[model samples]
Target: MSAIVLLVLGLAAMAAGYLVYSKFIAEKIYRLDPDFKTPAHEYEDGIDFVPTNRFILWGHHFTSVAGAAPIVGPAIAVIWGWLPAFLWVVLGTIFFAGVHDSGAIWASVRNKAKSVGSLTGDVVGKRARSIFMIVIFLVLLMVNAVFAVVIAGLMMKFSSAVVPVWGAILVALVIGQLIYRRILSLPVVSVLGVIALYALIWVGPSVPIQMPTEVMPGLSGNAAWILLLFGYAAIASLLPVWMLLQPRDYINGLQLFIGLIVLYGAVVLLNPTLVAPAFNTDVPPGTPSLLPLLFVTIACGAISGFHGLVSSGTTSKQLNRETDARFVGYFGAVGEGMLALAAILAATAGFASVADWQAMYTAFGSGGVTAFVQGGAYIIHNGLGMPEATAATLLTVMAALFAGTTMDTGLRLQRYIFQEWGEIYNLPWMKKGAPATLLAVGSCLLLAFGAGGADGSGGMIIWPLFGTTNQLLAGLTLLVITVMLVRLRRPMWYTLAPLCFLLVMTIGALLLQLRTFYEQGNIFLLLMDIVVLIAAILVAMECAAALKRSRAEVAAEPE
Candidate 1:
């Protein structure tokens, strides 16, 4: 089969979901009210809460939720074969992710813009809140830590990407000022930002950056970059959303879309034949069963609990209107679906032949970001006539920028989780922004250096738990939305059904990983997995009680 055929089919599916399914969700299910006041307007602080343009908010939500997972997950999952990964991304985005993401925003917006964990207290009972917050924190911890490592490794390997990735930050700062200060129209500013970012990509090859000799003892190059990244995230999280996060995500969103277009267009131009099987029946010695693993492996592009965090944690606070939830939330999932599709195509079809692709996938985890970058660069080199160095730099910067945006947002969300705990326990100091941010960054640092020693790759230790924990959190988040729907006497099959399916798959994956972790004598992951499993069961118990009560109340009232 030709790559163009898959490309056309995937893009068409995303478009149809956005146009048809999302409309039914926004109007008939979510019943979004355009005139409903949003927390962005209600809170209206110069800091975290500020009304934002829909395009800009969508960009923020899209890139922050996207991270490197959509790319990394699909790239890795395709080892099982492209067919399962492809089907999940297409269908999951339409049915599961779109509803869950947009519904999260609507639920939070209705409840005065509380984060999902905090709002769990309001709807699912206070006990559930504490349990839910723990899961959210773990997810963020894995996200911030592992992404820091991923970006640092990419920078070390693709030194040319280093300059453009950092340069894009400077460009975002300028774009932020231009848009907020009204110094330029959005279209003009957008055009300038994209051009400047691409120009930086052009300049990156000439100005490749290498880390200076160890800043301190025991700090390897990767560790130094990890520290620097966390430092940047700490500062970025403390800044106002309009100033850094929004503009950075917005421009990154545009740049990524262009990168997607280039990759998709390359597929069309080259019409590369699919190199991997649609469904591989060949035996890999230790490959896990495909049943639940594929779902967890492709968690982000399909459906993620972390996207619920982005939606409720930050996106809800910036939404200018309730109706924007559909775009900012649902279409945000679609954007990631697009990215996931590009990843599948790059990993499977960008290779020259079946044998070449086979060499790359010698093991379950062999073909990852490396495969993505190499294969994608091949297509761009062959199809678009771009210099090989430039093509590599472009994709590398794209991955780094998305990961950076996610890190920035994850740190901020982690800060909020701290503050939420503060409120729950009545700790005045923890509720403050500065202290909360310090705690967030400090904890992530402890996990990095403390666990991984000099390399700061400790996040990978817990990353195996990320997919299962994240999916369970998504299931929990959906439960919250479903309970709200039951309270309002609204149709809730859309949310409830996905909730059941995810919980079953995620908990099963958790149980499977537990056995593996135990057999390998990995005590840390074993303990962490057990903790997550317990938390999910406890929260589900609380939510079930709440759901029963909600249904009883609804039934007692007349329609």
Candidate 2:
């Protein structure tokens, strides 16, 4: 029940798992032979395929994995209880996430630094490669759509009379990049940019930015917001990475890191008691049991399918040494788990009444920007010397920065996947040497359509679907890693432990999703649930087939 105890236990579990268990997996199973040549060395291109310092690579990996999902998932999970949320994150990351990420990096490295799709095909079976690609494409589409809505909703909530703080920060970032990277030697430009960012925050309330008052008469604000956000995503996807996505992510990462520090520092300074119940006895009639829903709700922080794409798509190609993959991949998973822990701490600490948290949740429904700002403000007001309004505004700025970072990174990743998808599908219109600008634009449009809200509400209908798909992708990644471990002849106990845990958790979650869809009777959600269920079954069967084939091959070798 003690927050400190839980924190210590969680951290300890993560450390032991990564240091002891993961290292064992790396040495015995993955066996990154020192003599083996990595793809980065074999095909060293300056662009996308260059070797980089392990530390720098770690930075890139961490920045890519740590995003709005980490923040949002934990924030919501704590609604059930910090205990369930915290435990799932800790245990899940240690066993499920860390292993999956580490294994993925190793798999990619061992297979000539190919993407997971390519590796799956080469190692498991040719059919696996196609499955991997299709699964990833769908997952990317859902991920980008969900995030687009999240950012748009935040923007709509926060927009005011003065220049939009997020917009200003974005502009400043572009200008800073131009000055430092392109124009060269303008320290003042960067300094002025920072000052301008803060000033815009100060003046945010006075500035007026247009928000659609009514996208459709019957549509809820959230729905309308989703549509508009996805619409923007479509456009953003087609643009050059540098023009918006990369710069935004850099700013976002900086702000998120700083905000986390501030929040954690305040938690330590205040040492507030844990007031929420450790478990909720009265469950809603239709909600899932703790066994599965907990894992599903905390997907990103614990383990995410998205990480596989990141690992194989970019990080694997840039790894300088095979040994570095474990550090970058496993450590990155732990870091994300810790971020979820921070959110758990924030939601659980200092509040005497559940009503207080409920009030914030409701406010989030109505006044998205103000709700988070006020939540942060409330924490500061209770724990520090800052004025409530000032604290709220400061927190709001931080939240905006965080969202912007997520949007930028998410959009860029979406763009990459879109281009790859185009190539794979062999779209004639997307011929070689086509302008990067054209591709960016086209990708953005595709994303916008999916992210847009149904019924002209402008709120995204895709998010619920996205959540299911995202978790499904994670399950698929875990399945692949498990097969890889088996192929490498890892210790049965070591490979089976995490593999079995994830299989149960993910499959249970999928079933629960199916049940929910049937009860809700939402055709779209139901269809997604069915698709995920099928994917889950397919992943399970494929692993079984691979394992059987490997066993037969071993028997025939006469060794």
- Per TM-score, the best of the predicted structures is 1
lDDT of 2 by residue, 197-223 (tens): 656666776674656666667565555
Q: How much lDDT does candidate 2 score?
A: 0.62
- The superposed Cα distance between candidate 1 and the true structure at residue 50, in angstroms, equals 0.8
How close to the true structure is residue 283 of candidate 2, measured as C-alpha lDDT? Answer: 39
Q: Which consecutive 10 residues in model 1 have the weakest lDDT in total?
A: 535-544
lDDT of 1 at 318: 96
Superposed Cα deviation of residue 256, candidate 2 (Å):
2.7
Instruction: Score every model by TM-score.
Output: 0.98, 0.80
Using lDDT as the measure, the top candidate is: 1
With candidate 1 superimposed using the best TM-score fit, by how many Å does residue 232's alpha carbon deviate from the native? Answer: 0.8
